[model samples]
Target: MSPLDDEAWEAWSPHELGQRLREATLPWYVAGGWALDIWHGKQTREHEDLEFVVIRNDADHFRAILHELEFFTVKDGTTEYLPPAANLPSDVWQLWGGDMRHGCWRVDMMMEPGTPDLWIYKRDRAIQMARSDAVRVSETGIPYLAPINVMLFKAKHCRKKDQIDFNFLRPRLSLEEKEQLTTWLNELHPGHEWIKKLPIS
Candidate 1:
């Protein structure tokens, strides 16, 4: 069994989790498969961990909070205090117990650049639950994302994994937003095969 029980998830639920970091209200965003679900409006598959994009300045605070949640220093000596057994990428911090393959106990956090101040004004925010009851663990308990922000992120990365996430999220977008994304993609990588090869379903 995983270290996180039902109650633990309650604490980590999107809204509750977000609230925990609200004091700092660090510039964080969702990324990876979970972010794809936010962009698509539905979960295409289970996630292994909760991937977050944070500003580098907030890294220590983020680590401290995870420790409070019982996440030990699995890789304290490595570059960036990684959990060695978790085998994550150099940039990711892997917290124990999440069934990462199916999107269970692992929480992966990373740092990324934020939108410029002028563009930040255009971001959107919404509340969602792991299930559909509008229920959350705390004030910030709901899962949230900036759809356009995630979309732009996928566009720039364009790796196989990124394409897969975009594929899962694409069908959930409005026709206009889809068009805009397509236009953006074209501009980002003119005639890139990703536009034609991704499975819509």
Candidate 2:
């Protein structure tokens, strides 16, 4: 059972993540808004929660590692308790970890597509990259998903916060990164305004 029996959250910082998963044998990378912040080398905006990813096959492995917390599968605004020994449903990709000791939610465990050695874009599976290129380590020793991958995910949603992230990150993209994003966006989101915003050539 969840400690509080209610939905509440207090996310951990990237530093806390480093301490917790330092010895994890498989790859794990800080994801979502926090990832972008890590790439930018500072907290550029407020984050409502912390998120991280492991290869889909390793989701349960992490759930066991963070034994102090219990995981609940989140799908379309509803959450269901996921028993420790059970497998995550194929359709469920997000798990909210409840901090049993603290009586609040802590982090989100995103079970993204792709193997530990490769990164696949969830929105468009055809877009791929070597996993080494998909992740970057911060100076503080925290691993984070690359900014371009984060931006690609954000572009699909384009919520207010996503727009803010794009605004801040667009100027920082390298010529090659911008070109890559442009090509992918054209294939997946043709006529997207962000396309126009990117450099032409």
Candidate 3:
């Protein structure tokens, strides 16, 4: 669960947030439910907040672009504002961006492991792909996670929203994408219900 103060936080659209980081040279892509909406080329459902991913190694570059917002480290259900010079724990990957005045979280940033050329799946580092293969850009310049990759992330939870996402994306996946998703699902979550639904090739 996110430790966000709903009333105090103001959400930004993916494009809006992307524009804020236009000067950044590091690779970043929108993740979570919003990514799915971006892939569909329209809003499919209401989103609680927006999320994007940056490589762990590029954290400093990411911070440089979003310097106006206060960054907080979220770990073990507790949230603490990160001092400008403080180092984030190795196990802590999620950072919440807050408004300077009200301290309300507006962006949820996920720090992933990889380089500019490779995208290493955090759950299983063995599962890897070229960074180019893992993300795609919208016509409007918003970059988002590939649908198959996003579905793989959602498979572990399978919450109501996850189910909705799965149902919506299942029919849209290409044969190759479905095969790739199924292979990873079987390797990472052997008995996941989603595997049964994936088309056999």
Candidate 4:
């Protein structure tokens, strides 16, 4: 289940997402557990909902492109309909799109911090990476966030699924990626349980 679990979710598959956003020139990438599965070349576990990240400023552009969905701003535990071309409240960084036809939620769109060229950790702006390094395109032509980065975000929320994702991908992470994740966890989530488990080369 997603943040708003009560609603039905007929979320788009990663392939479906790639197909729809294929023409989108702006930076966007599949996120959450799906990203790890893409990197692993298999679905380790069933995903509750689809999630993706895009530049906050380009959200309107995406809304214009994903016509099948009706975007809504999710703020302070409330979900409100967001009109097309409307600016999201500065404080509202999350959105949920519903498919009127199916009467179900489709995707969880995350409006991320920073510019198109640089990927900035919203929680800590000081931590940054080149967009190229942060996003990796799969052989199937789907772009996804780096598994390391995904795990780092997952660390903040220790749900059962999050733990599953972390354990499943942790061993597969390269030594460099592990060190990077370690540094990030130590800095952003000091004394995080995952830190002790991440062994460095």
Residue-pair clashes, model 4: 0
Model 2: lDDT of residue 116: 83
For candidate 2, lDDT tens digit of each residue in 1-201? 543443487888989977988778888999899999998888999998899988888887788888788899889877888888888899999998898767788888988789888898877788889999999999999999998788888878789998888899998899999998898888888888799888946
What local lDDT does model 2 show for residue 194? 90
> Candidates 1 and 4: which is better by TM-score?
4
Name the lDDT value of residue 150 in candidate 4: 90
What tens digits encode model 4's per-residue C-alpha lDDT throughout 81-186? 8876577888999889888776788889998888878999887789899998999999999989999889888889878999988888887888999999999999
Where does candidate 4 have its weakest 10-residue lDDT segment?
1-10
Which candidate ranks first by lDDT, i.e. highest? 4
- Candidate 4: the clashing residue pairs are none
Supply candidate 4's per-residue lDDT for 94. 89
Overall local distance difference test of candidate 3:
0.85
Which structure among the candidates has the greatest TM-score? Answer: 4
lDDT agreement with native, every candidate: 0.47, 0.86, 0.85, 0.87
Model 3 poorest ten-residue lDDT run: 1-10
How well does model 2 score by local distance difference test? 0.86
How many clashes in each candidate? 15, 0, 0, 0
Candidate 3, residues 80-166: lDDT per residue as tens digits?
777656777788898888876655667888999889899888988998999899999999888899998998899888889989999
- Residue 17 lDDT (model 3): 94
Score residue 22 of candidate 2 by CA lDDT: 78
